[model samples]
Target: MKLLSRAFATAVAAGAAAALVSLTGTVGATAAGSGTAAAPALTQVADEAPGYAVEDFAYPDADRILAEQGIVLKRGDGHITLAACGSETGLLEVWARSKDKVCFRVSGNGGYLSLEIPSVYGVKGNAYATEVTMTVEDEEKSFDIAKNTWTPVGESADPNGRDHMLVEIRATR
Candidate 1:
């Protein structure tokens, strides 16, 4: 029985040795210019890595929106977004002579959008406290809108009733 166990252990040891030699031989051959491809260098791997994504905050599909809707949507924090009027309740509404009506959906703790809509006169606020900036010629004016109510803005609020272009909107909950 002792001789049988000793022979089995010797066979197992020889098998393990052979496996180690086979593995090392392949690795050594690869290292010693044996036609096998080497691992990529750190610099080469880094150079092929994907680039970092950077957000410009510019409005997406702005040209299409401007061409289709006749409204210039420049940029925003993604909190305020254009929406079709009456699509849903609780949307901020703007009344303009050039565009007639434009609506925005507001979300998050606060929201802001920079845009251009000519001859704006009235605004209907949502749940947020809203403010709008308008420009007439070289003069600019701002109006604070009452929450969940309509407020006269731009040319309607102007003493001289000059046509005003809506430029920016800011809202806070």
Candidate 2:
């Protein structure tokens, strides 16, 4: 697929160059007939090629999230999007670190995302069948979240109330 895209781009560039050369020749011929008209300068045509391919798992707002909320969002499939917590109803709520809550809005029939928010202890789910993964120290844990309700996870789920980082969330219809 990558090779095909590159080849297509190369073909487009070659076509543009050919068009420029032909246009320059036409202008030169017209100018030679009468010294009145100035020969137009040769200009490279603009590329109409498509944008670079996107990585499916790349986080779109990782830097912005880190800067605004002090959370390092990693990679996700884009089904889940960051939202303003508690401000809207029916959104997934995540409690982490110093931030009061980092929110996510789920869409489509299912959603899957990976992120990094330290000291997560609780989450409130929406209408999707939800699952979340968290990590603490050398141990990792997974929790099944109740839909349309608040469910304690991470440190809250742990018997010792150990601090943990929310790592991933997957939701399905």
Candidate 3:
């Protein structure tokens, strides 16, 4: 009986912890602050090719986390932006990007929107431009220029879908 009670309490605590985490946001990279880097730009002697031009990715269902706002992708100065669609069906949604850091990502709040009721969320957590987008929501905000492992997840259920995800940008690689 005591063990059972302990187990029940443990489950309740876990549920509460998960609730708290969801109340905040999922684990993903976030824009720290507007403040620029404190240290001076380090000089690199090696000459690397043009990095992160237009690219395509197969985002998994796990990375398909919801976007309260949408996802943004860019390479070099130019970029491409994709918004999340509300409906389950997918469609190609595209947008141009500004010049800054090539191969970078940014994500909108999810738990902030998910925590509220649908109607309340519809009013407060309202999702925009979710109907037409073919791409999935970007779940990976942690971009690595060196590893090239930072692939933001936008969802596409259609396995046979072609050109479902298209990213057009000028990269140094």
Best by lDDT: 1
Residue 162 CA displacement from its true place in model 2, Å: 1.1
TM-score of candidate 1 against the unseen true structure: 0.77
After superposing candidate 3, which stretches have Cα over 4 Å from the reference?
A: 26-173
Question: Can you list the residue pairs that collide in candidate 1?
Answer: none
Model 2 RMSD in Å is 13.5
lDDT of 1 at 109: 92
* Model 2 TM-score, all chains together: 0.67
- lDDT string for model 3 (40-151, tens) is 5799876997677744342322123224323333222212123344332222222222211111221232110111111000000122212112232342111112221222
Per-residue lDDT of 31-104 in model 1, one digit per residue for the tens?
45464556756654464768889988899999999989989999899999999999999999999888888999
Q: Candidate 3, overall lDDT?
A: 0.29
Worst 10 residues of 3 by lDDT: 115-124
lDDT of each: 0.90, 0.82, 0.29
| Better model by TM-score: candidate 1 vs candidate 2 | 1
lDDT score at residue 9, model 3, on the 0-100 scale: 100
Clashes of each: 0, 0, 18
